[model samples]
Target: MRTATPSRAMRLAAVASQAYRRVFAASRLAPLLSRPNPVHRTGYDLDVVVRRIAHEAEDVVSLTLAPTDGYPLPAWLPGAHLDVFLPSGRQRQYSLCGNPNDRSVYRIAVRRMADGDGGSREIHDGLSEGDLLRVRGPRNAFSLVGTADAYLFVAGGIGITPILPMVRACHERGAPWRLVYLGRSRTSMPFLAELERHDGAVDIRPDDEYGPPDLAAILSHAPRGAAVCLCGPPPLMAPAQRIMRSVNPSGSLHAERFSPPTVAGGQPFAIHLRRSDITVEVGAAESALAAIRRALPDVTYSCRQGFCGTCRVRVLDGEVEHRDRLLTDTQRRDSMLVCVSRAAAGPLVLDL
Candidate 1:
């Protein structure tokens, strides 16, 4: 006596009705919608002065920031990142590598991407000590959960920034933890000196010396009930995830990715904005959000990598090929993040 599951069309219609009702109810309840909702706001923008800037490695610089107004900054936990608004008008997210107990200043490290969108370049060239900059969030998308088991941490290149604090926390708590830090070379790896303090618990594998890490062997040898945390390039993280899934079925492996997963042979599609009365062609090389921005320049977006939900839009019609990791299954059925999602079928309609 099992009930039949609703079809995709039926599900979408039901969701649309619910969304319409919610919107209508909100319109009638003026008070509820009138006041500024801080939750919907992007983040609290704070002005901070750069206290110090030092080179941690080749093309890697660490910046220490303190409040310009002499007030205590918001507290952050391990694996937190800050959204820094650069002088070049580009907003980028950087992991907080400094000690969490220290309230006097916050520190973050940056690696200059030679072919990036100029954010890291600005941090390297346009910034200096005593310079004021705007920042938002000490948000943690990859937080360490409370557990009694030992921990295994894997970091690649600049990915070590987030894991550094986690290692420190484990050390302070007398918890069992091991770190496998990988980089292209020893001279290019940041926080080597700091990690060397815990030599017994750290394995620094420079690619030039050790080739690639033996991930299969590492995961196979992981302690039972150990929580594995990984942060690195997609190429490395993708394969690591597969190995982790095979060896650890409990899904204790956690990973944080800064870049969007690469799509191969993406099909070109069209998006119709119902409210804006516009239809934009999304080329295979361009994203839906980019196409929309060409017609409507004021659209809000952050973290084009698709981790942030700042560019979410309601879907009125068409199947979505969601590419983001942020949305839950329920949310994905009705809405899509325009930054990374695309239409699975021909033309998709949006409630923009």
Candidate 2:
């Protein structure tokens, strides 16, 4: 979620409302604060064979993969996703929907969007059952921290993939959980019938058949310590989050973005490569990933947002103004995500 900034009007109103107060903690107020970004992570490659394929929705395809060498399947927690190295070296993230406990095969759901740039559409239009693709990761950006007093799973369109396993986890752990699955229509929704098995625990809101789904009402049911996880377009998350805050509180609601944040050019920073001893300039026109690859063509990266952590390198010196939301506060102080983060000042050194 993007950070919120206080407007001048709010400032003026606060000044007028608290005009009689001797002192006030306005800076401590949320209106002045910006929401922090979620941490990024890395995953390893596990090249697998596409054992089977099934169409779940008009734009969605489900794939069953097997280890090419009969290696043990990557152990994944519920609500995990994997990044696939597609044809032409393009990387895309997909949510895992198969049973985590049953480790024989890994299942994933991919939706071809109308605005999708070739990659997803290719999965729908060209990928076959026998085709093999380089697959990496079974990672969880939206991991269940095992803390929530109750769980509320809200999903939209292809976002349903991640939530499915969460619902299953809730059931397995005997945790109090509810799912409000939203889709454009019945047939267009993948795994609808299967989810209906949890009839009382799940609510299916198809846009074609139902009145507008009320996020506020649904959020009201979220008790304290309730962890609300959402995966979908930016719009779907905003309203749901609004209700989450109005009813529950901030930080109680969590979200996962398959895409990275927009690249707003910050002040130029110098990058010093200790291993290579090369310094490169990165600005709005270039990223550390791009600059490093330019000097060192062999550098590999998948998700540039630093979530995949593929391009992570050691920080030998200098203050790195971390912009990517993927690094832990501790890790940020020690290392750097070269993909999105840059040095806060000039002459930054990296142990590349």
Candidate 3:
């Protein structure tokens, strides 16, 4: 059976409707359909597969991570570090030691600390080559910036991870640089062979051979106006910081500490956890997080240096003595990082 044909007006109306829909879809109003380029994205959280893992030195192991999505990663600079979330639910930061130009993968070296926390031990023993790990930020708290006559890098033990990239950058730019790589022995230091390949002068002063490096002798090789970059344990960094000022007063000193910074003027304070109904006493030398951890052992925190906001808690009352470098003025009005910040006086009420 033959059906009746559509009227002319009805057919024209249908054609006009189709045209209007097409135009609207391509307009600015349809932003959801227009996907932004992933390359320009910043502060991205991703699950990356461990492509390779290798032992670098006596107690050091390096992990290479590749994006599971098979896309180029966000670009990073010399001193950028990644916040790695382990399968054990522990979060730790490791410096990027690989080439910055190569965006395909990131490389980080970890040294096992026998007496300290368990994060390093987890990476060295438990992490495998095929495991998937979540990571955030190639954020740089220690950036290699500004113009200098030359560069002097002092790396002790695993602190070489961040300064390795900075030395490579200086070599590529045809700038003068010297690295004083310090360790207990040559067998214990990572990247010793890699440093030899660079054109700059590398002084491998093992404590066994050199008998505790003389800061005066080390500074003698560096140019007068050179920028000094140092990262290491408190024993080495504490003295280097003092001598750098005396020897090269004209030079600029940039130091990064792996351990927690020493508390100078902190006074004893109290923190009252509102939800837990418990009060923790913060000692003059101990951090607020340390005190809280004793009362409540399951608190979440990473980078106890106050850069990561994992230990942040809402303040119910009391004036805060802010010491963190991450939070803004708006966020500081109601929040405080227990790892570094403390009460101005008396007791501080926290949301737990």
Which candidate has the highest lDDT of all?
A: 3
TM-score of each: 0.77, 0.70, 0.86
Residue pair clashes in candidate 3? none
Clashing pairs in 2: 38-325, 39-326, 40-326, 42-308
Give the top-scoring candidate (TM-score).
Answer: 3
* 10 residues in a row with least lDDT, candidate 1: 33-42
What is the C-alpha lDDT profile of model 2 across 1-352, one tens digit per residue?
Answer: 6644678668786566444221222233321121111242233356678889998887788999887655346567777777888776767778889887665688998888788556788787777887888876666667775887788888888888888888998998899888988888888889987787798999889888886666787777776778888887656765765677777783388777555544566666678789997888877655777778778876766667667666778788898878665667887877877778877776688888
Clashes of each: 0, 4, 0
Better of 1 and 3 by lDDT: 3
**What is the Cα-based TM-score of model 2?**
0.70
Candidate 2 segments exceeding 4 Å error: 1-44, 239-242, 262-301, 311-320, 325-352
List runs of model 1 lying over 4 Å from the truth.
Answer: 1-43, 264-267, 272-280, 283-287, 290-300, 313-336, 349-352
Model 1 / residue 68 / CA error / Å = 1.1
Task: For candidate 1, write residues 1-352 as lDDT tens digits.
Answer: 6665678668887678556544643464432332221123224477899999999999999999998756456667788788888776667888889998775799999999999767788999999899999998767678875584888998999999999999999999989999999999999999999988998899999999999888877776668878899998887787887898788655488788877655556789999999999999999977898899899876767677676677899999999999886888999999999988898989999997
CA RMSD (A), model 1: 13.0
TM-score of 1: 0.77
RMSD each, Å: 13.0, 18.4, 9.7
